[model samples]
Target: MPHAEAVALSGHKILAVGTTSEIEALAGPSTRRIDGMGNTLLPGFVESHLHVFSGAYGRKLLQLAPITGRDALHKAVRQFSDANPDEGLLIGQGTPYGILEEDGPITRQKLDEMEPVRPLILMAFDFHTAWANTPALKAAGLFNGRDVGPGNEVVVDQEGLATGELREKNAYLPVLNLRTSGGREMLGMSGDEPETPPSAQERADDIAVLKEGLRYCAAQGITAVHNMDGNRYMMELLREIELEGEMACRVEVPYHFTEGKPLPILEEASRMSADFNSDMLKSGRVKIFVDGVLESGTAYMLDDYANAPGWKGDPIFDTEAFAKAAIEIDRRGLQISVHAIGDGAVRIVLDGYEAAQKANGARDSRHRIEHIEVYHPDDLPRFAELGVIASMQPQHPPGTLGLPLEPGISAIGRARWPYAYAWRDIVDTGTAYCFSSDWPIVAVEPLIGLQATQIRTPWADDMPDQRVSLHEALEGYTWRGAYASFMEDRTGRIRPGMLADLVLLGGDIEAVVPDAFPALGPVLTICDGKITFEA
Candidate 1:
């Protein structure tokens, strides 16, 4: 009974973890007891890559474009418009290519009739493209058919008229601002309070949203998350949360860098990294976009798409510019995560990393290439040789299966298609890799991502050979993701002394049908010796 007398929470940190009886002995007379009921425990799960603010925003916005298809999209958008007639812009998010039934892109003319006066900006499921109406285009100063410049494009017709299809950051930023501003306004308008500019107060509200989202993640057993996008405001919010002792999850925030910007990189990085608290909130790495998505044919490609003839993909930054940035960033002892979906884009990133190494000797910088969807056979070994991590999303291949069907299969062709999710080959060659949901672009559920890895075949009966073992798939989500974020030593595995972040499943993963894993739900989610979520 003396053993039970000991209150075993070793001073706010897990002082000792043992059987209930052993732990009980350490309990003091005033010790509080919590019943475990023989439930399974695990280390908390960590999400390697995600846009936290955007994910929360998406949850608030119109869910017009479900990844399932276009009819659902049209119905959802129409319903939202019908209900919120006073809103200036009819906005929606998440529409993958495979879901659309329309032959061509979603045009402005189609959305014009619904609310011809109000602007409309419906983002593609991938967030790499946008479907804007004429009003939205005009509002964004992209009415005329012209190159909006760098990482942005306006899809045009034969006569050079804006087709309402905007690709990459070019078309996305303007509309993105409109959505952000508009969402804030909506939040203010809903209440009987005076609407002010989105000051620190608004951001505090957003921080509250983030905390709620983190709680949701913890309940699902996520212990850490690699936040792909977080600005100074977000960082401030995080600091506030930490100071208030409200921070419960470990977050690795990556600073974003654009091509032309030079001075801001060091200024921002130094400011952020100088004060970064490694305990729970730390700076992860720097993020850059080298190319767009493969489904949109905007990703830089070595060869032309089978459907879109005379068109190889587009690159956001030229080779020289990319190389220069990579060198400077690498020299600063910061990791780089570049978005490169196509083979050509991947090659360009590789070339940049190689240039950086040549300029400054080989360092332990674990530079990463995000979305290496298509890889040239020759460049497969470069990942391992250069020590680059392939940060990929498995759901893209299975989710975008209908891409070949729409816009003609000629663009992708058969030979190049087999190399989409080449996880086995990448690992065989000694390259490290990780997986993410790219949530809001796709579903945030890790099970869906794992399922895609196990069954590489598209919705149709194609490309079965690309499928990988379930263990390999799970590793990508758990261990590989941790390695990419540089948290391998602290998280990922369910070992003693690690943070008590773990998930309890309704059923064992090994016993369930592989394909049905996507439907599996978490029964409990624990984070940092606290219960975050309980089903």
Candidate 2:
């Protein structure tokens, strides 16, 4: 258990972990042997946060990450439209903020110029904002701005016509509904079940899409995925896959308690917790969004933005409302995971957790704060004090992982630079934290994520170095992630009695440099004693 050179698996569980000779002694004649070929073998990576279902479907959409100017955009749109002639709505994913250099704001007219007739929608990299063409807006009934709820906006012009800039999920849900899949991809984020249940054939298609996503995760050496968004419909699909014995990864779904939903809706979360409690497909967690992302200025900051005067940001729930909901969820014995990006939102989520502890009395809730991108120094220690987990994505930091620095850095301001995506500070405080990709928002590659943490540098020389050691980085993606998801006792370590979830890297992780990590991938991935991926 201290440091083993070999591990033996038998029937979906580790039989022994010891020196090569000791492990070999335990093997029988019928045992299948695998040679690592000097590659490093580790517990399979646990993705702590991601939207698996939608990310799978997003693979088919046109990617705008590589495009820079109008000419390129026009060509890409035209080509995509031509390629998918039967598709009703043309959707583009990973469109960066300020993609159009000459833009005031991304207006419907500008998008119309790119694709005049076919309806088109471009999703921002953060997934917090979207821009639709005039046709798309008209088709979705956003031509005349409709009141999208609190903490969401549909940008409109002086004459009260939609401008195609939609701020949050509610603002864009209508346009997304025009997709060929009927917006089923976003139903988890919207915290709604399908209004009309899918037919038998439709169910089969949905299952296939999820199967592809699971296969993708397996290929990435991901044995466990903590989906940040979900409803019963998604869980049902996963359950079906599990029953069919085709599930490749361990999936943990959460019930998303979106804004405007009644507090009693948490009962559904309890129901899910009871219905699917298997290790492969389980749900006993509730997810909520306290605020949006920093890039869009929807992040609830503690103080006014450096650029925008008197404007901090909007919060999905106030302190009282959030605390009340937290108490009830905690009392029901369910873990809570809230999306809190800005310092203000982080503080609110922390306050709500503390309130839950005070009201329900403390238990091993293992409640988590997702995306603590910006943290207030004053509230840093609460993570350890309240036994909360900091579920973070290393790829989300600006200046690394293809993310632009301006909007996020300027949004947080100079005074708060020391705390923005401050991984080192949080780790030093002895707080429990885990790493993830927040996939589709960022690529779901654990090695890339580990490289980001190892190679990350501060925005300025005056700021503290936020880079973490390789061991810490690995811990964040493996055991720490397993602990965060309540699977530490089952998997996360290549030890005897643990689940047979392991990944054989293409090269020795200890000997490789950070720059070459992207080139190195999983040569073999095993889950539940089955070889899930082999390269």
Candidate 3:
């Protein structure tokens, strides 16, 4: 773990950590040498949070992140539609909330102007909201608002027609299913496997997408991924990929627990945990969504939003139900990871975790709260007290990593700016945490993430600086991330006997300015002692 000139890999574990001369003496003729070229090498990146299947499939969709203004939006949509003429549905990813110059709320009319005929749905960058054209809304039968359960809405106008603004997963899922892949990639978010089995061709297509995603991760120097959304079918697909000897990154999936699912569903989660308890692919965690995101005015906040004064957002689960489920999940010994973005949601989840501890005595649960974008200053210490891991995305903070500031900052209100994405505050409280990209929401590039964390600018002159040190950020994506996922012994650090999951950067990360970190990427990536990528 100390600073060494070189580290040697043998089979699937580190053979030696020493000076270059010392390690060279142990190398056999068959050993392949990798020249660092004055670049830095360290443990491979561990993506602490991401939706791999969705991120993979999203790559096939038209990206709207680069396109701007109404003219560009229409051009991009028209081009994408023309290219995929026969495709059942046209979907766009990374659609900005403020795509239009004058935006009240993005209506179906805006998307209709872009691509009127084909069912078009532009998903917001955060994946919490989406805009669907009239055809898409009709195709999904959401033209007339249907009850989409709690915390989800098919927003309708004064005339009772859908406004095209679909909030949260439940509302937009029907529209998503219109795609050819049957939206199996996101079925896991609702804690459901495909209603019926896929045909052989469909299965093959899904496998191919998974392969693409894994390869993409490998290229980014990600040796391990803690997938935030998935189901049994996804696990099976990953297992098949592993068997085919094509798995480029180690993956850990969770049993998604949605609102309507009964407590007995925890039994199914337990089964999943037992079934896929391997090093390559594992399932020993439960994922739950306590609220939606702030951008869409849906994140359950403690107080009214700055824009919408009367509205405080919605909670996905009833307080008692979530507490009970948390207790049961804890009792069953599954690690719990909840998606909670607002201060209100953060409090509820913290209370639920505390309830679980009271009911089922404490163990090293290492329970995680994904995306603590905003939290009450008083509840800050609970993360450490309850032993919760702050699973966060450095790219998510508004104004960092090219994210816009208005919508997210306004949602939190000016009064709470100090508590929003308070990375430094969380760390100072002695709470364990890790950083991630939350891929497809952003790109799955750790170096970009490192830069975002280090170069984060304060919202106001008086606000506390939230930037973390370069080494601390690196550990978040490596050692600390492994520790969060319970894979510390197997992967995190560069030491003798640790698994040879390593990344060699193109240039020394410390030598460059913070802004230049994004340009520095993996020259070589090795996972399980196999050269997964070499540039």
Cα lDDT computed for each candidate against the true fold? 0.69, 0.90, 0.90
Angstrom error of the Cα, residue 271, model 1: value is 2.4
Each prediction's RMSD over C-alphas, in Å, is 5.2, 1.2, 1.2
| lDDT tens digits, residue span 371-453, model 2 | 99999999999999999898989998889966778788988899999998888889888989999999989899999998898
What candidate 3 gets wrong by more than 4 Å, as runs, is 181-187
Per-residue lDDT over 373-401 for candidate 1, one digit per residue giving the tens place of the 0 to 100 score: 78899899899999999887776664342
Measured against the true structure, the TM-scores of the candidates, in listed sequence, are 0.87, 0.98, 0.98
**Lowest lDDT 10-mer window, candidate 2?**
181-190
TM-score of 1: 0.87
lDDT of 3 by residue, 359-473 (tens): 9998999999999999999999899999999998999888886778978888888899999999999998889999998888999999999988888999999999998888889
Candidate 1 runs further than 4 Å off = 1-41, 67-74, 98-104, 179-197, 399-410, 458-464
RMSD of 1: 5.2
